[model samples]
Target: MLEDKNQEKTSLSELGEFGLIKHLTKHFSSYHKTTIKSVGDDAAVIDSSEKQTIVTTDLLIEGVHFDLSYMPLKHLGYKAVMVNLSDVYAMNAEAEQITVSIAISNRFPLEALEELYAGIQLACNTYNVDLIGGDTTSSTKGMLLSITAIGKANKEDVIYRSGAKPTDLVVVSGDLGGAYLGLQVLEREKQVFQVNPENQPDLDNYTYIIERQLKPEARKDIPELLKELDVKPTSMIDISDGLSSEIMHICTQSKTGCKLYEEKLPLDPQVISTCEEFEIDATMVALSGGEDYELLFTISIDDYDKIKGNPNLSVIGHITEENQGMNLVTRANQEIELKAQGWNSFKG
Candidate 1:
């Protein structure tokens, strides 16, 4: 939107790196008592007294992880934070701080960065995490963001991917496949725009899916909700990679196998209908679509009654002995070998 409007563009050189950092992070304030120091420091300090600290980092690059033609800079900033925070929440920890580093080319002006930082600040305020410290540098090509999120949890409360037991039930929060399908819609629209710039694509049917892609929220409430329900997950992971890939991560690390049922996958109504429109199998989308950001976890079957009626969670399947191997139970009652066909950066 900023690019479309003819407005004054301030050069980044006027602010310098330190000046720009100070300006961008001026609105950020610390919420957690653990944050000893926030922005404008040599290094941000946190006092995680008695609690275990969780740290997670993710890198997103232009023309690779995203396309600026379709992706807004503000949404990109918000999403960069959410992606890392999602990893922290996967460990059942509450994210308290994040240090965001970015490298941008000269094409982005001061106002452009201000818009990006506005989104970042909004995420911090919304999620109640502190913007601690980071570095800024000039890039030769395009924008690159690397965010490191810090979280805290009691030693006994932290969940690990290797903690799943054979009899534990596999559960997932919210729905799957919406974000991936959203990307498909956006990509299609981009192609259409290239062919006809004046063509206005009808996107009313894709509102939910598009929102899911642009502004995915990390499941910060899932851990708190589970604690409120007195249900601790045996093992947990956020659905960033596809369902099958993440499931395999848990199973391999835990030395266990799984039986994921195709029918049990939680799908939004839009996701189902969109899959039909795209002529893609909904089951395949649920299995291999990435960036859902929902938490997938395992719980002891003994606690089944507690969460049986929860609408936010879907009990997909159960863990099995390692020798049984990971398999997907089709709705037709046939077993298919589960494969990790999710996103792979190096696959040419």
Candidate 2:
């Protein structure tokens, strides 16, 4: 009793990569004169002129990126925008606009969509960013969100990943691994709740770590502080994939190595307690736990005075020549090769 007996459906795989690109391009027409080229190059080239531009994009999928069981729609929306804005800050730029697109299944009610948008609006208000154009569509499965953020900076202010030099001091904003420990607490509580329905999970003790995981904030103030201190980082990267991975990225890109002092790795008291409770190595967590969203950068030794005694910052390591390789000097005075075991989605 179907209404459209002659209708045929096509699978995304059937169209292949090139075909899908063509199909999507057909629906869009260029409107900006600054778009020098689009859709068919190794990268999109724009006529930025005298102004410096920053570009960042993020993709959030159901199950992998979030869980409806604990993640609220509004928080998810806010987080989506915040994650992109963090990238803008990492580039030392001011985020001004964002384009959000979502693919949702029919299971989501209109009220749910409204709740999500409310979060997005909150982020826009907080960051002073405009809600630019985007698209909505029906998904074959669950919900998916993709956002592209654009920001601006002065020509001289833009930061890149390859500026680190030997002997520069490595610094990080905020503590690390709290977010990972927080997630662990949430998962443990979820398991406990599953074991007994009548028992309400007691998360009163793990509030700090849990909040660090669920509502992580980008280091928005670091850029402003840098300007005030007149210190430009020799190289910088955000701790999205853990400090070890990010440090490796900076070192590899700059053709340098580093020696991180284990005692210098910052850890919130809550993170220390939680890691102990879980019987996980706190140092390993600080090294490899992701989602801290802190800034990891290297500055010339001369700039050390600018950040010294700053409660929000810590000097963790020092860069070395590439031939020295990356190592961590433990509190026990043992040198161990640093390993980047940052979250790998494909490996589960």
Candidate 3:
């Protein structure tokens, strides 16, 4: 009986493409009004109605973008969806559905894939988004995930990265650098385990930053908060590739300049302490440490009071004329050119 049970264990080849898709996606159900047809079809049917649709896709490679040694499959699943949805929210739209495609090597068993889907389901439930459809395939090497998020907004409410003007106030939601610092802690612990396999890591000190890396949440509330406050962002983006790179993107796309104050950059207390322990500059970490997933936006200076003292928002800088150039004003009053040093998946 044990031999028969072992033989009955299904492999990717045995299940084939259609069989695997049916088995895995059977538990998923649609929850969005726009998701007219989810799964079991040639394509996902979305009823956009009178609203404009916003779509964004992101691909994460195993070895290049994430190290599976430290990143659990479940967290990877949740983070994948969050990363794509962040882009949708950045456009000031509401994410309604997502299509998740994955390529996994034969080494992954059916149960392992189930664990990944569990996390995906958790995220979908938390954000109230529908799992419309996706593809599953075999990979020659490590696992890879590609997620495409679809959102909607009125034509007048849609925000773009190129809408910032001079004199606009620059704002960011939540503290920066926690995710990058979390990566550092994880890498260090991984090395320690490699050298001494018996040593159990004490991760209590790194809890916050570690969560920031492994299970970062997208800012799904910022857009809603802006709507409640009657404030429309002139420009916006999610801080996936570091604040410096994202700010540079906004400035370049808007054909404007910016002055970012070093002191005004938000940092969690844990991030600050971790930087001190690692002897790293917190300011630099906040500027170039990517994967924050917070929303960075620009608003009209006239509407500043609505968000001025809100704990969830931080006013970090202001837009400047194109001729002024992008500069960082240090605490000591030194002006320096800002550069983009965020995470580069293609970097060798």
By the lDDT metric, which is better: model 1 or model 3?
A: 3
Q: Write the per-residue lDDT of candidate 1 for residues 17-67, one digit (tens) a residue.
A: 445877899998889887654543212335577786777777899987888
Candidate 2, residues 311-343: lDDT per residue as tens digits?
Answer: 988999999999999999999999999887887
Please give the TM-score that candidate 2 achieves against the real structure. Answer: 0.87
Model 3: per-residue lDDT, tens digit, 122-187? Answer: 899999999999999999998999999988887677777889999999999999999999999999
Global lDDT for candidate 1? 0.88
Off by over 4 Å in 2: 1-47
TM-score of every prediction relative to native: 0.86, 0.87, 0.86
lDDT of 3 at 330: 99
lDDT of each: 0.88, 0.84, 0.88
lDDT of 2 at 228: 93
Q: Which ten-residue region of model 1 has the weakest summed lDDT? A: 36-45
TM-score between model 1 and native: 0.86
Clashes of each: 0, 0, 0
Instruction: List where candidate 1 sits over 4 angstroms from the true fold.
Output: 1-49
